[model samples]
Target: MKETPIIAAGLHDTRSLAQRIRGQALRMVTRAKASHIGSALSIADIVAVLYGRALRVSPAAPRHPERDRFILSKGHACVAIYAALAETGFIDGSLLETYGADGSMLMAHISHKVPGAEFSTGALGHGLPFGTGKAMAAKLRGESWRTVVLTSDGEWGEGSNWEAALFAAHHGLDNLVCIIDYNKLQSLKSVDETLRLEPLHSKFEAFGWAVREVDGHDHEALTKLLEGSPWEAGKPMMLIAHTIKGKGVSFMENKVEWHYRNPTPELLDAALAEIEGACGNA
Candidate 1:
């Protein structure tokens, strides 16, 4: 394993951390010629906030019994969380170089084998159900820890997600929180073209969840909302984070092609430069 510089910063540095996540994911996808760079970019800030301030987890004690659980339902965007894990010390940054290579734990999709990843979820609709079960278990065990599941806007098409929503509400699982990365783009087209999820907030409300919407890139708002989950007692929290696809990279923003398009070598250089310039060389 090759040793690389790690950014071992505290909570206050989440903005910089988000930039690093984007830069890291960009490079990883570029190296492997993998897909879903856009998906990963869309949720970079959200993931950064989760690891930086919201999650009650420790890299040194990744499997601590009392730690909060976070599941990424949009597992195709694994690079973002992988980057977060590396940056925050849950795993060595060097392992990132092996990403998408043969037999690496860092699969294209998120996997539980990776440190700090609570669940392995590549199939669209499984994350919420699994996370809901975990939340229910916590409630039954009288544990104070919370369960957070981040799903893609496009994933709302999965009937299983709705089933999990109803189950969570029926059980009054306030400790459960679900965040949607509403980037409005899916694998090959706009989410509206693929499947309309309008009145998304109202849909969650009907399912008995406490709903809130925010700009996904706003670090302050994201941290505040995520850290202060379960906005209402006896209700699951549904936060719809409206975000732009392919965020941070000038050429890729909101362009659906990026969903399956890996950045070319020249594009990778430009993307890294933009990300590093935005966050600085520090």
Candidate 2:
């Protein structure tokens, strides 16, 4: 499919935005002495594309009715989403420093208290169903708004996800889009070893969703897939975004240990350097 002119024009800027968010997320996690840095990095690009290019969100009026809805199913990775929201002007960037702090609005997981965030989610398997309900509501109201759900490959183990998947297909909620961060590694081990969700694409197809697999870190590809509406009529869409767990950092990429390890000051500096290099190249 040809790139829409609007999407093409924003591709570089969106990538730069994502890279910046990744850097900020890394710094936030490091400063907070928290974990999930790897998961946060894994979905940075996807979050950027959603907020920067695709999602119809109002910074000044985040609750705008016609606006699209986004649910971060893997809420542990919400640092990236929060960074994107701040960068997009939906919230204050200064608030990022308080992430995970006591009594802070930004918790370790997502919270609806944050403007632009549609739903608060940390428990796995909840986001997909919530998004499905939102999409169904939109459909019932004859609204054109879309609902996008972002989940990790690891979350597939939850039976709730499958139930929602089946429900969405049965209801033919065409406006719903599910993006899977297939970064290979989960918390304990690789996704393959954890549950063996191989042939993931076919599984979605079997559930009656139109499926497309793409490089999660490729901004242009993500933009095209999202904008193109690869799904058929009367079907939901699923994009399996194959990605690296710790994408931008050299030593952290594909390393399972980073899943729950807080980056040291030196490591944080190195990761920021890598992100800066990526920005320059973009």
Candidate 3:
């Protein structure tokens, strides 16, 4: 893997990159016979916006001391991260072919073994806590680096995330940013049918965090929201991004069954074709 340096300051069209990410993710899942295609598809645009514009990271120096930190709290949707890393040049694109193969660093779950991955997370409710610690450390050291944790809305039911939220709010960790993929679908069922998190807006307010809601698939909106972060100067930021499960592919959109379904060869072709058209228009 010949890693190349990335110029963090340059801007790119993330909307276009999002299509590529989704395409790569679909292919990865289908090839590996892995699951979570819906989960990965849901966050494609959000990840695109971050890697395309908001995040300050370097592909060559994966451990760039001053780079921004991103944690995929919703790690089941890791194919998106893998795609983003390859898209952003953090790792060789060819390495993605090893996904889900035995002995490959690209395990079924997100792994810290990957070059740009900050933490290995599969169990629910772990990413936020680990990210909180990283954010706290940055604050104590007076570092300018920001810690962004991308979590699934379903994970909100976990007590650990709430505790981490409390810690982030109390300490005034303005550098901490959490983006929840509120796709409204959990693994086996819909979030509403499982653990309802209605009035989600007010809940964050009550927790002492600055909150905002946006369309998770809107790359422009995501970029704008991220650029104007620390929404309140003294609190952490919570962006409740409303997204659709199995977004993009017509057959998969909003279908809960897609949570664990891998695309067959025919389905993969259709998905990739849809993404290809989207990329052209993007």
lDDT of each: 0.91, 0.89, 0.90
- Give the best candidate by lDDT: 1
Write candidate 3's Cα lDDT for 1-282 as tens digits: 864555374377887788889999998999999999999999999999998899888887889877888999888999999999998888899999999998999987899999999999999899888999999999999988898999998999999999999999999999999999999999888898999999999999999999999999987789888874578898999999999988889899989889988999999999899889767775
Give me the runs in candidate 2 sitting further than 4 Å from their true place: 1-12, 228-230
Structural RMSD, model 3: 2.5
Worst 10 residues of 3 by lDDT: 2-11
* 59: Cα error in model 2, Å: 0.6
The root-mean-square deviation over C-alpha atoms between each candidate and the true structure, in angstroms, is: 4.4, 4.7, 2.5
TM-score of 2: 0.94
How large an RMSD does model 2 have?
Answer: 4.7
**lDDT of predicted model 3:** 0.90
lDDT of 1 by residue, 244-279 (tens): 999999899999899998988999999988888877
Q: Estimate each model's TM-score.
A: 0.95, 0.94, 0.96
Residue-pair clashes per candidate: 0, 0, 0
Error of 1 at 86 (Å): 0.5
- The 10-residue segment with the lowest total lDDT in model 1: 3-12
Sequence-dependent TM-score of model 3: 0.96
